[model samples]
Target: MFGLKDLIGLIISCFIILPVVTFIRETGYFIISGLLGAKNPRLTIGSGPRFFKFKFIDIRRYYHVYSWFSFDFIKAKSKFAYISIYAGPILINAAVALVINALLANDFFEDSKTFWNRFIFYVFYFVLFDAIPMKTVNGKPNNGMIIYELLRYGKRIDYNEDPIIPGTTEAEEEYQKEVEKMKEIKWKEVEEEETFYTDKKG
Candidate 1:
């Protein structure tokens, strides 16, 4: 039966645990790609308008909903390099889950065992989805699919012109443009509302 405890757990999972796991997953990309000499890398968290940015990390308003890592270019552009980059998130999450599981088995963090268990669960959940070779709902291939294609054909099979990792500069420019458009729309709405009130008053 659903109760207050379940509700609290759900809130923690959605807000805190999930966001941390997501940040870790995206960090896998940053770490692997950085090692391979990726230039101008940026890790963007969430979607919609920007909230704030710190160094390489960009936090959006609706944080915890979505996140991605982007780089302008990679020095080592080989099939093997691409495979490693794609496999990064899967391996990283799996490693974290295993470590947590082991710690739990040894009776570590007994006081917050439930929290740690939930954390491990979400970590493995991320690993499972990332390690599976399939296209997402938007038709874009996931990391597993990309790795599989590279292993089998030694090349990306998808004819999509867009690169797997977008350029940091390009992404920022596009985001700024989106913000401007949003501001313009809001201004228009405010003007219309004011005009409507004036007419009604007169």
Candidate 2:
């Protein structure tokens, strides 16, 4: 059995990923060169099954199709009409899991809505996942860019947290090198952060 900490971490990550899955399922489209002439196009599913699938069309192309579909599933070319289709599942699925956990514990999160819960979950999820890169911009895993972009674009990174661009800043470069060192040494979070800040701050 996993410990409470592990369970909590899982839920947080799930919430973030679930919405992205939903967004992709709904709005995003993939094209496959392997679409067999024999198979029924009528029965398309996730990752579209084809004898040989090819790269999905660009996000822009999918965007056009989704727009016409009226924000539904990929039912119409224009259905599932949003770019953040994957985002829905990432958010909702995690929420559902957390909700179930809360209900079993007789904690409703006050009708499944609490700002503090949301914030903490986001923080946990961001810390874990921001370490791991997400694939955007043509399914390319943008590694260090994740945390950088969140800080840069979303302004989630605190002013107190160093504002170094991931690769450009010497401090950030050192930070990343330290992260790699921890990974190499398999240092746990407490040890990693402690050492990282100690060296960087000192």
Q: Assess candidate 2 and give its TM-score to the true structure.
A: 0.22
lDDT of 1 by residue, 45-162 (tens): 9988889999888989997748999998899989988999999999899999999899999999999999999999999989989989988766778899899989999988877667
**Per-residue lDDT over 1-202 for candidate 2, one digit per residue giving the tens place of the 0 to 100 score:** 7999777756754554443433333221222101111111121222311233233221221211121001112333211221122233234435544554566467555664443455445534533442444554444333234335454564332333432111113422453586588576765777889999999989
lDDT of 1 at 184: 99
Deviating ranges (above 4 Å) for candidate 2: 1-80, 107-139, 142-202
lDDT of 2: 0.37
Best by TM-score: 1
Worst 10 residues of 1 by lDDT: 156-165
Pairs that collide, model 1: none
Residue 129, model 1: Cα distance from true site in angstroms: 0.6
Q: What's the C-alpha lDDT at position 61 in model 1?
A: 93
RMSD values, in order shown: 1.3, 18.1
